[model samples]
Target: MTKQHIGILALLVIILPSCSYFDFSPDLRFCDDFYVVVEEMPVLIGGMAELQQKVVYPELARERGIEGRVTVQFIVNKLGDPTEVQMVRGIGGGADQEAVRVVKQAKFEPGKQNGKPVCVQYQLSINFRLEN
Candidate 1:
């Protein structure tokens, strides 16, 4: 083959791979999904101090003298509201219930990923201490 023809063939070979790699099929569509943002945290009713005061000592914990920390997972909605409360860790008896009660009553400022309000999961730790 002529040197010119050979050079043209070599160029085509190098360019072919890149063309295939960059090709986007006309029938295909790509979409990116994103989450909403929360503007502010929800306000807790009576605040954290009031929540602690309202928390009742678990009867089971009192009976068994159990003392430890319980972790609760919940979601703060866009409106700074909490919901879907569940115990990630339990301290047994009334302690669990007390933790749930306090968490439910506690309000968050809401979390945002972007600029819009979105539901975000949060974890809270409740510690029960036995007084001497």
Candidate 2:
């Protein structure tokens, strides 16, 4: 084959793999990763106060006076369901698990990317304070 033909074939091999046509491959870069930021971020339907109300303060935590903030990280999917819920910061005393549970039960208005719903990584902090 001519050198020109060989060069073209090599170039195509390098570029084609990155094209959308080959997105089905197992390459992580081609995967539809959850966006950290989007054109529109997901919103909790009833606002933060509503979410805080849903939280049932852990009895163990209250007994121990474990009062602080628990931060949770989760993925808000295209369907507005919270998935992959996890605690990013915790004060222990069952607070971590409680935080995760509350976040898991919560639903959001799915984030938008280019005006279309998409999965987005979201973080929220819930404060735990004792009544004075």
The model with the greatest TM-score is 2
Give the per-residue Cα lDDT of candidate 1 at 126.
Answer: 81
Residues 1-132, candidate 1: write the lDDT tens digits: 999999999998889767967664431111123123235433455666666676677777878889998888777765566677899998787888789888877766656555655566667788887777
> RMSD, each candidate, Å?
12.6, 6.8
Candidate 2: residue pairs that collide: none
- Considering summed lDDT, which 10 consecutive residues are worst modelled in model 1? 27-36
lDDT of every predicted structure (CA atoms): 0.69, 0.87
Tens-digit lDDT string for candidate 2 (46-130) = 8999999988888999999999999999888888888888999999889899889988888788899999888899999998988
Residue 96 accuracy (lDDT) in model 2: 91
Clashes of each: 9, 0
Candidate 2 CA-lDDT value: 0.87
Report lDDT (Cα) of residue 56, candidate 1. Answer: 75
